[model samples]
Target chain A: MTFLSGLTPYFIAVFCVLVVGFWIQLQREKKPEEPTGETVSTSKARRWVDQDLQDDTEIPAKNDEDDDDDDHGSELDLPHVPYAPPRYPVASMLERSQDFYSLMNQRRSVRFISPEPVPREVIDNVIRTAGTAPSGAHTEPWTFVVVSDPDTKHEIRTIVEDEEEVNYRQRMGNKWVKDLARIRTTWVKEYLDVAPYLLLIFKQTYGIASGGKRKTHYYNEISVSVSCGILLAALQNVGLVTVTSTPLNCGPRLRVLLQRPANEKLLMLLPVGYPSHDATVPDLKRKPVEDIMVHI
Target chain B: MTFLSGLTPYFIAVFCVLVVGFWIQLQREKKPEEPTGETVSTSKARRWVDQDLQDDTEIPAKNDEDDDDDDHGSELDLPHVPYAPPRYPVASMLERSQDFYSLMNQRRSVRFISPEPVPREVIDNVIRTAGTAPSGAHTEPWTFVVVSDPDTKHEIRTIVEDEEEVNYRQRMGNKWVKDLARIRTTWVKEYLDVAPYLLLIFKQTYGIASGGKRKTHYYNEISVSVSCGILLAALQNVGLVTVTSTPLNCGPRLRVLLQRPANEKLLMLLPVGYPSHDATVPDLKRKPVEDIMVHI
Candidate 1:
C-alpha cells in the first residue's frame, strides 16, 4: 500500500509534465485566425504615427492633439491608405557594371576577437543599413537587442552556459557531439561575456498585448531570417567581425533572463567585436559557384 | 456492395496521398549525416587527379595510382589548394556610396506591370548577385528556375490562375478577401505569360540519388530566404522591378508543372520585367530606424 502511494505521486508528476508538453506542442502548431477589430486598428495607427514622424518636418504641439483625433476619425471616414510600393533608383548599366563584381566578391564571414569596442555610430549605421531589408506585409517583425553592458553580458554568459551544459552533457546524442567535435567550442561561454557587444536578434512571432490577445504575422521565420542576413551584411560592410550562435535549448532561458514579452522568440545570438589576437577559424572551404548555381 | 466498392477506392486514394505527404515531410526534416567508410578518400582521389592534370605536372599517372594505395598517403598527399578569392579593384566605397544610398532610399515594390521584356543580361546579373548569399555548412540548397519560354510561361499562367480562382472563390475567408480587395490581383493568367521571366526559387530540402540514399540539409528555409532577399536586392539595385507572388495552393502545382525533383520544394514565385507604363503601386512607407532598434 505504501509503495503504491509513493508511486502514485511520481505517476502524477509524469502525467502533469506530459500534459504540459502536449499543450505547448499544440500551441506551437496552432494557426490562429486572422486578427480583426482593435488589433488591425492598433497596427494601422502605429504605422500611421511612424510614417508621419519619419519625415524631417516636426508636428506642432497643437497639431499633435488634432492628429490624435484625426487618426481615430479618419479610420471610420476614409479608406485606409494602401501599402506604398518600394521605389528603387535606376543606376546606369555602365555604372552598375563597374562595381557590381567587386561588391559581390568582397562579402566574407569573419570570426575572431578584437578588443576594440565598436563605435556607437558604426553600430547605429549598421542597424540603419539592416533596416533596408524588405519584410512581409511591411510588418518588419524583428528586434535588434544590442547589449553592451558588462553586467548584463556576464548574466547572459551564465545563462547560456547553464543551458549549453545541459545540451552537451545530456540532451545531444553521440552523433551530434561527434559532428560538433571538429569545431572549437566550449561551455565556458566566454564570447558572450568577452565580446564588446552582443546583438540578440528576436523574432516577434506575433504581436501581443498585456492582455493575452495576439495579432497574426505572415511568414514569420522567413521574414526574420531575411532581416538577420541583411544585419550580418551591414555589420560586415563596416569591417566588423561577428559570429552567429544559437544555443538551441536556451530560448526559454533567454526569454526569462531578458524579461522578453511572450510574443517574441529568440532567433539568434550574435557576438560582435574585433577578432582576438591570434584568432583562427577552422580550415574550411566553400563550394564553388558552379556547384551551387543551376541556370534552368 | 456498389457503395462499399466505391468507398474503398476513395479510402485507397486518401491513404496513398497521406503516405506520400508523410514521406515528403520526413525527408524535409531529415539532416545530412557524415558519410561512412571510404567516401572521404574517394573524394580526395578525384580532387587529386583533377589538380595534378590542371597543374601540368609531368609525374606519371601510375605514380598517382601507387600514391593512393600507400598507407601514409594523406601525410605525403599534395595539398588541396583553393582558387584565390575573386577581387574587384574598381568597386570602391567612395564611388558606390551615393548610388547605394540612392537605391536604398528609393527601393519600392512594383505590383502592376507592363508586358515588357527585360534584357536577358539584366536578369542574369540579378541572379548572379543572388548567388553571393552565404549558406549553412556551405551547402547552398537553392535552384533558380527561370521561365522564359512562351509555352512554359503560358502553362504557369494557367496553373496560377486556376489556383487563384479557387482562392478567390472559396479558399480565402471573407476577411482575407476583404483585406486584399484593394490590391489589383486577378485570376487572369496574363502576368505569367506576359512577364519576361518568372524566377522560381526552389529550396532543396534533401539530396537524393537514383540508387543512393537521400541526405537532409540544415536551415534550408533560412538559407533559401536569404538568397531570395539578395535576389530582390539585386533586382532593385539594377533598374528592373519584380513582384513576389504566392498563389493559394499553387506550390504543388508549380512543382508538377516544372517537373521538379521530389526533394526540391518551391519557396517563392517571382515575376521579373519592367513595370507597365500606367501601373501604380500602394503608397507604403517604411518604419523609422529608432522604432526598429533597441539598445541595451
Candidate 2:
C-alpha cells in the first residue's frame, strides 16, 4: 500500500497524458475533412498532362474582383457605348450559319504539314482575330509566339521529341505496347520543323497591372483556350492545316526556348501551313448535333 | 529515498510515454504537408465560382489511358486515311483570313438582348459547328442544353438572379460598392428572361463506355472551352450575340433543373439573341497585334 501510494502521482500523470493523446488523435482525424493549405495535384492522372495548364499556378489574389466576369479589365472602367452590330435577315443568318458550319466541319487535325512558307501577314491577322476574344475583366491573357526561324523550330522540335518520347514510353505500360499499333506517330514531330510557322500559344497566369503589382487573370486558361478556338477557326478560314498539340511536360522548356516571360505558360502548339499533298488523317466522325445538344 | 525508489517504475513509464507522445506529435505535424484525400476548393475565389467545374469531382480513373491527347478514342483503333482538304492559293488565303478576322473582330458580348425570336435551325447549325471541335482522345465530352421555352428560361433566370444577388451582396464588402459604379449590370439579369434562347454548356467529366464502366474525359474542361470558342465564332458569323455568364455557385442547381447526367457539369451559360436596339457595351478596345503576338 505504501509503494502504491508513493507511485500514485506518476500513475495519474501517465493516465492524464494518455487521455490527452487520445483526445488529440480524435481532433487530428476531424481535421482531414477541412481544407488544408496544401495544394492539389491537378496533374495527377499522369505526367502526360501539360502541368502548366493547372489553375493552381495562379496564387490566390488578394482582391475578390479577379474571378468574376468583370470583362472590361482596367478598361472595365471605360464608358459604355451604344453597340449595334450588324443584324442580318433571318434567311441570310441561316445561310451564314450553314456556310460557317460547312467550313468548320471540314477542319481536321492534320499531322502532315506542307513545307510551303505561309504569308506572315496572314498569320498576323489570325492572331489578331484570336486577340479579339472576350477575357475575364477584359484582361487579354494570351500571348501568341510565332516561331518561323528554321534553327529555333529545330530546337523546339528536339525539345518536344525528347519529352514526348519519355512520355510515350514511361506513361504507357504493356497496354501501350499493344496499343502502339493504334498510336499514330511515335513522338517524332516532323511538322514542328517542316511547317512554316509554329504558333506557340501561352496563357499568362497573371498580369502586371499599372501599379506594377501582380494582377490575377481569372479564367486565364479558359480565356486563352477560347481564343485558340477562334484562332483555329481563322486558320481553317484560310485553308491552313495544323494539329492541336498540347505537349506534356514540355511547357517549361518551350517557354525558355521562346524567351517568353515566366507568367506565360504554353497552352497549345500548332504547326501552321498547308497540309502535304499526301497528308492523311484518321477518318473520325464527330458526335452528331443531336448527341451533343439537348433542347430543353 | 525509499519513496523515490517506489516511484521509479511509474516515472520510467511516464517518461517513455512523453517521448512517444512527442514523436506522434511530430508525425501529426508532417501530415498536413501531404494530401489527406480531401477535395480542393477549386471554387475558392468565392462562392462566386461554379464548384461543379472542379477536376477533383471526377474519380481517379483506373486506366492509364485517361489524360493524354491520343486524339482517337475507341475510334482511335480506326485506320488512318488520306486527307486532302481544300488548299487555297496565297492570295485567296490572305483574303479569307482578313475576311474571317473582320467578322470575328466585330464580335462583342452584348448584354441587352432583343426578345425577337431567332430561327431554331440557325441555332442548330451553330451548335453543329461547335461540335466539330477536337477533343482529348476523341471523347467528345460536351453537352449543349438549349432552352427556348419561356417558362424554363424564367426558372433559370430566377435561379441565376437569386444566386447572383447573394453573390453580389455577400462577396463584395465595401470595395464592391465602389466597384459597382464600374460594374455594367447588377444581379438582375433581364436577358435571362428576354433572350430568345439560353444555351447552357456542360462538360462531361466522365463517360459511360461500352463496358458499362466510367471513362475519364481527359482535358474535358479545356476541350469544352475550346468548343465554346468555336460556338462564339459561329454566333458572330451568323450576326447573333450573347453574354457569356458563368453563374457563381449556380451550376448544380442549373444542372438539376436541366436534367443533365451526374457526369455533366455546367462550364458556361450564354443568353443568346440579337442585341436590343438600345443595347450598349463597354467601349472596349482589344489588344493590338504586336501586343499579343511574339514573332520569334
Candidate 3:
C-alpha cells in the first residue's frame, strides 16, 4: 500500500511533464521563424539548360508572418502616393469599353508560331503586369520562368512531348480525346521549339521560412491561374501571342531541368511569340453572353 | 459437352447485341438536340427577392458541341465584326503603360464600405466586362449573382458570420489566427449588408448537356479564377471598389438561397460599393519586383 501511493505521485509527475512537452512542441510548430532574405544577383540572365553555370541566387524571401497589418517594414519602403482617376463622360466610357472588348475578342490561341525574338523589356513588363493579380491573404504565390534559348526550348518540348504521348494514348479516355478533336492538337508539340520564348509558370505550394520551416499557402492554384490570365492579357497588349499548355506528368522533370527549388510546382507552360503566317485556329465559337451570364 | 456447345452460340449472340447497344448509346450521347433559343426578356429589371414574380426567361442555350468552326448558328447570332487596332507610337505605348501601372498600383482591398446605392447599369456593365474573360474551350463556365436586396444581404451576412465564428474559434490553427491578426479581421462581417451589391461568383464544375449527359469542363478552377481577375480589373476601370470575401461552408446554403442550378459552385463573394467617408487599408507592402518576378 505504501509503495502504491508513492508510485501514484511519480506517475502523475510523468504525465505532467509529457503534457508540458507536447504543449511546447505545438507552440513551436505554430510559429515559424522569420525568413532571412537572399541577395539577388545582377549578373546577366543565362538559360540554365544551355549553360552549366546558371544564376544560383535565390529569390528574396518574403516575411508573410508579420503582415497582419497594413504597415510594412520601413527598409527600402516606397512611400504611398495619392491617386486620382481621370474623369470620363458616359459616352467616352462606352467607347473605351467597346474598343477594349473588340481588342480582347481578337485574342486567339496560336500553335503555329514564329521564332521571332521578343525584347526582354516587353517580357518583363508582361510579367510585372501579371504580378498585380489578387491572391488569398495577398500571398502572391507564383514564379514565371522565361526561356528564350533554342536548346532549352528543344529540351522542354522533348520532355513535354514524351509525357503527352502517353497521356493521349493511355491516360486520357475517349471523352477527353473527343473534346480535344476540334482543336486538332495531337501528342506532337512542334511550337515549343518554334516559339522564341517559353514562359513556364510555377506555383509555390508553400513558403519556406528560415530553418526550412514550411508556411502554408492558400489558394495557390487560383492565384497562379489568375496571374497567368493577366500575363496573357499583358502579352496581348504588346501584340504578342501565347497558348496555355498544361503538360500533365511533367512537373517533376521540369523542376529538375530548370533547377527550381523543391517548394515549387509547375502549373502551366506558355509558348510566347508572334504567330506564323500560316497559323490557323479552329473556328471555335464562344458561348453566347446569355448562356454564360445572369443578372439578378 | 453437347449442352455447352449449344450455349456457346447464345453467348455470342448476347455479346453482339450488347456491343451494338453500347455503340448506339455512345452515338446518342455525342450529338445533343439543337437547343431551342429563348427570347430575352427586356422587362424593367427588378429586385427578384422583392417581387413574387421574377424575370423567368432562360439565357440562350449555347451549343458547345457544334463549335467545330468559328461560325455560330445564324438564328439571333451576333455577327463578328472585323478588328483593327489603331497604331500608337512607341512613346504613346510607354505613356499608356505607365498610366496603367500607376492606376492599378493604387488599387487596394477596402473593408470599410458605404451603403449608398450604385446604379444598376453600372453593375450590369461590370458583369458584362467579366463575361469577356476567356475560358477553357470557351465554355464560359461562370455565373455572377448580383444581390442588392437588403433582406437577402442580411441573410447572407448572418450565414457568413456563423461560419466565420466557427472558423475563428475552432476550425483555424494558431498560425492561421496569428496571420489574420495583422489584417484585423474577425467573425463580424457587417460589410455584406453595408455594401450596396454582393457579386456572388459561381464556377461551373461540369456542363449538364441536354438529356442529362455530363460534359467535362477543362481547367475549371483556373478558368473561373482568370475570369474573376478580369472582373476585378473591370470593376476597377469603372471606379468601383470591392473586397474579395471567400465564405467557407456557405456554398450549399448559397446555392439554395440564390436558386442556382446544381452544376454551379460558389467560388468567390465580392462586396461592391463606394468606400466609406473614412476608409483605410493596411499599409502592408508588396514583395519587391525581384522577390515576386524573374526573367531568364
Q: Score the docking of each candidate (DockQ).
A: 0.09, 0.23, 0.09
- What TM-score does chain B get in every candidate? 0.65, 0.75, 0.72
**Lowest summed-lDDT stretch of 10 residues in model 3 chain A?**
A46-55
> Which has the greatest DockQ?
2
Q: Which stretches of candidate 2 lie over 4 Å from their true place?
A: A1-77, A172-183, B1-76, B172-183
CA lDDT, candidate 1, residue A65: 24
Tens digit per residue, CA lDDT, model 2, A1-296: 99999978656755654565467446646885332222223232122212212343233455525433333233323455567788889999999999999999999998889998889999999999999898865679999999999999999999999987765554433223223334355689999999999999998877775555566666787888899899999999999988887776788888888888977888899999999986767656789888999997
> Candidate 1: deviation at residue A187, Å?
4.8
Candidate 1: TM-score of chain A is: 0.65
Residue A279 error for model 3, in Å? 3.2
Docking quality class, candidate 2? acceptable
Which candidate has the highest lDDT of all? 2
lDDT tens readout by residue for model 2, B1-296: 99999878656655654565467446646885332222223232112212212333233445424433333234333455567788888899889889888888889988889999999999999999999998766678999999999999999999989977765554433223323434355789999999999999998877776655566666787788899999999999988999876676688899999999988888899999999987767666787788999998
Measured against the true structure, the TM-scores of the candidates, in listed sequence, are 0.65, 0.77, 0.71
Backbone Cα, N, C clashes tallied per candidate: 22, 4, 8
Over B1-296, each residue of candidate 3 has an lDDT whose tens digit, in order, gives: 99999778556655654565467446645764411111112132111111100011112125434323222122111222222234345555455555555555666777777787776666666666667666665667888898988999999898888877765655554445556554556789889989999999888866765555556566666677777776776666656677876666677788788899877888788999777755656556666667766555
